[model samples]
Each structure stands twice: as C-alpha cells, then as structure tokens.
Target: MTYVPDPARYDGRMPYRRSGRSGLLLPAISLGMWHNFGGNKPYENSKAMIHKAFDLGITHFDLANNYGPPPGSAEETFGRVLADGLRTHRDELIVSTKAGWQMWDGPYGDLGSRKYLIASLDQSLKRMGLDYVDVFYSHRPDPDTPLEETMGALDAIVRQGKALYVGISSYSAEQTREAARILKQLGTPCLIHQPSYSMFDRWIERPAQAGAPVLTEVLGEEGIGSIAFCPLAQGLLTSRYLDGIPADSRAAAIDNPFLTADKVEVRLAQVRALNGIAAARGQSLAQMALAWALQTVTSVIIGASRVEQIVENVGAVERLEFSADELAKIEAVLKG
Candidate 1:
C-alpha cells in the first residue's frame, strides 16, 4: 500500500513552539529514536510508529549517532523510512541527529573534539541519507576539550550547511552559558539544549552550589530553547509497571541496562501516588508526566515502540494546563 500522509496533519492539533528565539518551530512533543527503533526491533513496527507520529502532527524527529544497541542502526533505519515514505515531506519535517558520545572505538571516535564531531556528523548524514539535519547537537559536554573548539566545530557545521542550527545535550548550566557565548561570538547562536528532565529527575531545577543559575533559567536568559528527554523516566511514569514489571517490559529486557527491577521498586510508591493524581485529573499517568516536564521547557522528546503508544502520548497536548492546587499536589507527591 502507498503510504500517503494525512492532508490535515497540521490542522493545529499539535502546538508548535519557537525553539529558543530561533525561527524554527518544534512540535510540543517530538519523537525520539533512542530505543526500540534499532535493528533489534522489527522494521515494519518502527515504520508504523514513525508514520503514526507524523500523522499526529509531530513534525520533529530526534536521533543520535549512538542511539541503537549496535550503534548507528537507528539512523540507518530512519534513512530507510525517509527513502521509502517521508521523502516527499522532507521540507515539512524537522530531523535532528547528534554526536559527542562513544560512537566507535579508538581515539577520535567520541568526545567533542573538532575532528570527531565533523567526522561523526558525516557518518550520521550518510546513515540518514540526508545532506543536512535541521539541528546537530554535541550530545554531551566534553570537559577534556576546550569550549571554543567544540563550539567552533558546531559553528562550522552550520556555516558548511550541514546543520541549520546547533545545540548541546546534557551540558551543565555553566557549560551551557559558556558554549552559548562562544557560539554567539562565532556568528551562530546556540539554538537549543537537550537535558534529561522528569519529576523523578529534577537536576535542572536544583540550585547549583557553584552559584550558576538553573539550566532552564540560563537557557531563558541566553535565548536558547530546551527539549527534555526521559520526561516519563523511561516507563516509571507509565501504567505499564503499576502492577509489576511485565516480562516483556524494558526493565525485564536483558539488553536494556538503564531501567532495572530494583530501580523500579524504589520509585513504585511515588508512581502510585502520581497515578492517583492523574486519575483525578482524567488523564493517564504518562500524559501528566509529559505535561509536568513541559511546564517549563520548550518541548519534550517521547520514545514510543508501538503505534498505539504514539497515539496515546500525543494526547498530552490536549491537557497541558494545570491549576495551582494541582501543581502543589504534584510537588507534595514528589517531596513525599
């Protein structure tokens, strides 16, 4: 069957926000290709999720060089989707990829060095079969490398027409400030920052002992937008674990190391309390969790393995508003 996109896909069902004072407008919820879209997963299933996401007005698709279990497989999979289905709508999509993690073995395979970034992006472009990505991110801050060098490479990538905008991920507030300054001096403003933010992980809201501002505040002051990853805490915020870890769940999967049984047990009570609040508000736990992250950030990146999951997650846009009392209740639950 021909994969034709819905004509009414952009009928304002999903809200778009300006990415950090930039001209680019990203969907409130962007789909991330971190897990489940790799070679280990079924190709047809992954394709269905991507198609479903676009049909739901999710124009932004985020990926990274080291996303897949085997590394680089996710990009390769996305490349197939682009060639087969999304080629006609290329201009309407915001596709992004990143580096700065351990991509390949050896000295130049990882980090924010100029050589590694440039080469890694080249490989990423080849894997995705695209001339340029909408945004290219240094996936993490490289403490060993000078800020000027990493920011310079990002600026050069923009100038070379390889990436329309540049960003940093998992960078500390202080590091973000310095990188933004350097990119500005280099004639390329840092457009956005990708940080891991969820009710369980509130590092971005914590006051830095070094006197640096919180990450969200710094980005606001610097005119940089933010996109939060792991807004659901990797299934902890979802109903899938309410009863117990399903045998097929990510926590039970041997390949996934980030989420384990012990980790889920520690947060079970908190999740149960949060579920109660979600029930009272007439929304799913996952939806409320995403809305909580979006209360401050510009956008949230969602990872889905199934088409139904994408459909349900996109419903978060509908119930984004929360009253003051609701906010306090959520805070109380987190603190408790």
Candidate 2:
C-alpha cells in the first residue's frame, strides 16, 4: 500500500501558531512518540497513527532518545515509518528528538555536556535514518552541568547543520532566561521549551515567588515558544478514569512509572468533576484539558496508543475556547 496524503491537510481545519517570535508556526497539536511506538508494539498499529496524524495536519512528530520501554525503539519505529512512505513528505514535517538523559552506560553518554548532546543527536539521526532533525532539544536541564556548555552544545548543533533549531525542556524560569540569553549571544536563539503542564500540573504557570514571573512569563519576555508535555497528566485528565481505571489503562499497568492505580483512586473526585464540566461543554475530558492547556502554551504534545485516540485528541481543536465561568469552575475543582 502507498500513502496519499490528504490534499486538504492544510485546508484550515487545523490552526498553526507562531512559536515565541520565531519564524516557525507549529500546528496547535503535535504528536509525541513517548509511548506506543516501541519495537515491541505492532508496526502497522504505530504506522497507522503516524499516517492518521499527518492527514489531520499534524506536521510535527516529537521524540526523545529514551522514549521506548527498551529505549531508542521509538525513534527506530518512526524511522521505519518514514522509510515506508512519510519520508517523501519530510520537508513538510518538523521532526524533533532530544537528549540530556541517561542513554548509554558511560558518563559521557548522558547530560548536557557538549560531548553527550552531540553524540546523542548523532545516534538519534542515525536511528531515524535522517541526515538532520528539524529541531533538537536538551530534554532536561543538567543540574551538574554548566548552562553555557548545554546551550553551547545546542548552538554548535545548529552551526553543524545537523539541527535547524535548538530548544530546552524542564528548565525553570530563571534557568530558561539564562539559557535563552546564552543562545542569543551564540546567534542561535532558543526556538522552544518543552515543559510539564496541564490542569493538574500547573507549576509552569506559577511565579517563582509572590510577584516573580512564571516560566511562561519568562518565555514570553524572551520571545521563546513552548510545547507542553504531559498535558493530559498521564491519562488522568481523560475519560479513562472518569468511571474507573480500566484494566488496560496506564494507571493499572503495574510497571508503569508515570501513573499508579492508587493515585487515580485518590483523584477520582476531581476527575469526575472535570468530566462533568467537559460533558456540559460537549467535549471529552481529554479534549477540554488539551483545549485549556492550549490557551497558555503554543501547543500540546499528545500521546496515543491507537489511531482512534489521535482522531479524538485532534478534535480538541474544534472547540478551543471556553467561558469565564467554566474557567472559574475548573479552578474551583482543581483548588478543592
């Protein structure tokens, strides 16, 4: 079989927003390969989601070095998908991958050191069968590494033509300011920041102090765009838990590190309340959550285990706005 992309992919069904004063405009929702694209999964299953996402005008596919259960498998899966047919549309895509985590055994294989960042991306490009990635990220701030070295590695990657743009993830507001400043001096302005943000996880929206700027404020002041990760809070914001965690849910997976059944039980009240609000708005809880998060970030990275999930998640764009009372109610639920 062959891939014939939906000619109407750009027919205004999806909106593209400017990324923090950059020349790039990313789709409001980008697909993330943090799960379900692993080697252990059925190849056709993963490929279907990728194809479906692109048809829905999702031009960005986000990945990280340690994304798979076995690590490095997600990129391999994506690479295979591209080799199948998606590679022909490579120029129309924004393919990104990250480093700054424990990828290999040695000390030189992890963190923000110039050596690690460079080597990690090289391996990533190799795994994805690409000469370069559209965007490369630091993934996480290295507490033991100097900001200059990390940002410098990003700059050098751009200079090397291996990465068109560079970004950071999980850096604090002050840390973001310093990282952006260094990248600016190096002539490669930070393109974006990936942070953990959602209705349940709102640290990125808070000020460092009583009157200090939040991470988003720092990003706004620096003209850096952001794409929020974990915006669904590992399925807690979805209808999957509104009734109760299913046996197949992430929370029910005994080995799943992100969510646990016990935690889901504790938060069932809030989840059900949010679900009620979502129903009133004619949207699924996941859709409402994504819509709400989109109001603050440039885009929300969505993960999926099936193609149907991608379709439902992308439908969030259909109703991206909400009333002030809805926001107030949501705030009440969260606070309570």
Candidate 3:
C-alpha cells in the first residue's frame, strides 16, 4: 500500500511544549529508536510505529548511529523506512542522530574529536539517506578531548546547515555549563541536554565529581531544554516484568548490565509500590512515571518495544497535570 499521510493528522489533539528558550516546539512525547528498530526485527513493525507516532502527533524521532543489535543497523533500517514509507512526510518529522560511543574499529571511530564527529555525521547521513538532521548530539562527554574542539565542530555543523540545533548527553553539570558557555559564545547555546532520568536513577540531580550538582539548576537557568532518556528506567517502571522476565523483553534478551534478573525483582517491588500511588491518582504506573518526568523536564525521550507501549505512553500526556496531594503521595511512596 502506498504511504498516505493521515487525512486528519492536524486535527490537533497531541500537545506540544517549548524546548527551553529555543523557538522550536516539540511534541510532548518524542520517540527514541535506541533498541528494537534493528535489521533482525521486521521493518514493517518499525514502519508502523513511526506512522502511528505521526498519526498521534509525535513529530520528533530520536536516533543514534549505533542503536541496534549489530550497531548502525537501526539507522540503516530507519533509512529504508524513511525512503520507502516516510519520504513524503519528511517535512513533518523532526529527525536526530548522535555519534560519540564506538561505532567502528579504530581510534577515529569514537570520542568527540573534530574528525570523528564530522565524519560520523556524514556516515550517519548516508546511512539514513538524509542530507541533515534536525538535531545532532555529542552523545556523551569525552574525558580526553577539549570541550572547545567538540562544541566547535558542532558549531561548524550548524553553520554549514547540516544540523538545525546541537545538544549533548550524559554531561556533568560543570561540563554542561562549560559547553553551554562555549556554544553560546559560538552562537548556538546548547539547544538541549539529554540525560538518563527516571524515578530510580536520580544521579542527574546529584553533585558532580567537582562537588557541583551534575545537572545543578543550570539547565533551567540557561534555558536549555532537558530531554531525559530511559524515563521508564529501561522498562523497570513498566509492569512487564512484575511477575518475572519475559523471554522477549530487553532484560531477558540482551543481558545488558543495567537491567538484569536481580534488578527485576528489586525494581518490581518498587514498581508495585509506585503503582499503588498511580492507581490512587487514576493513572497506570508507566503513565505516572512518564508524567513525573514530563512534570520535571522539558521532554521525556521514551522508547517502545511495541506499538501498544507507544500508545500507552502517549496516554500519559493527558495524565501530566497531577495535583500537589498526588505528588506528595508519590514522593512518600518513593521514599518508603
């Protein structure tokens, strides 16, 4: 069947939020293709998810070059979907890709060096068959490279019109401030900061190695948007593993250190406690978790293994406005 844009796509139900001080507005629920959109998986499923996202008004689609079982496969698969399925809707999509972690077998394959960042974006563009990305990120902080060299490359990319805005992920507060300073001086001001934030992982609020809060108050102070990934804590917040690991779940399949069998039990208990509070407030545990993030950050970069998950997540937008009593109850349960 030929891809047809939704006839009522702009009927205006999905909510949009401003990203910090930037002029751009993003859909409250942005989709991230971190896992699952791989070559091994059926492309039609991923295609359907993207279409469903747009149908529901999810304009932003987040990606990384290395996001797949074999690495780079997600981008390649997404590229085909973009070409064959999303071609006509390109103008309606806010696509982004990042480079920082290892993608190939050499020194230049990683880090925030000028050569690596530029070359990686070029390769990512080729893989996705796009001339440019809406946003390009440094992925993570490079301990060795000078921040100037890194953000400088990002500034050049923006100047060259390869990326509309640039951001960083997993950066310490001091690093975030320094990078923002340089990027601002260079005329870009660090459009956004992507961190892994959820109910369980609160390190983003803690002090950095230099004794300064890693996120501090600078994100809000600088008016730089914060897009939190793993908002469901790698599915810990979801009820999928409340009983035990399902054979098809990420924890059951990848054996990623962050989500293990032991964590499943521990997180299940926490999820159950949180679920009680969510039930009191007339929301699902997943919905409450996502609402909490949206209440705190500029955007929640959520991932979904199924179309149902995305639908469930989008429903959370309606659940975003929680009362003070509801927030207090959630805090009490989390503390317990």
Off by over 4 Å in 3: 209-211, 214-216
Lowest lDDT 10-mer window, candidate 1?
A: 205-214
Model 2: lDDT of residue 10:
93
Better of 1 and 2 by lDDT: 2
- CA lDDT of each prediction against the hidden true structure: 0.93, 0.94, 0.86
- How many collisions per candidate? 1, 0, 1
**How much lDDT does candidate 3 score?**
0.86
Winner on lDDT between 1 and 3 is: 1
- Native-to-model Cα distance after best TM-score fit, residue 245 in candidate 3, in Å: 3.1
- Model 3: per-residue Cα lDDT over 1-336, one tens digit each: 878767776677677888889987888789999987988788889888888878888989999988986788888988998888787888888898999999888899998999999999998899999989999999998999999999999999999889999999998888899999999999987888999999888777777566565584888788888889999988889877667789877787665887887778766766888888888878788888999988778788888777888888888887688888887877776677
Candidate 1: C-alpha lDDT: 0.93
Clashing pairs in 3: 173-214
1-336 per-residue lDDT for model 1 (tens digits): 678998889998899999888999999999999999999999999999999999999999999999886799999999999998787899999999999999998999999999999999999999999999999999998989999999999999999999999999999989999999999999999999999999999999875776768888899899999999999999889999999889988899886788988889888998999999998988999999998899889999999988998888889999999999999999999998
Write down the TM-score of every candidate.
0.98, 0.98, 0.95
Q: 44, model 2: CA deviation in Å?
A: 0.5
What stretches of model 1 exceed 4 Å from their correct place? none
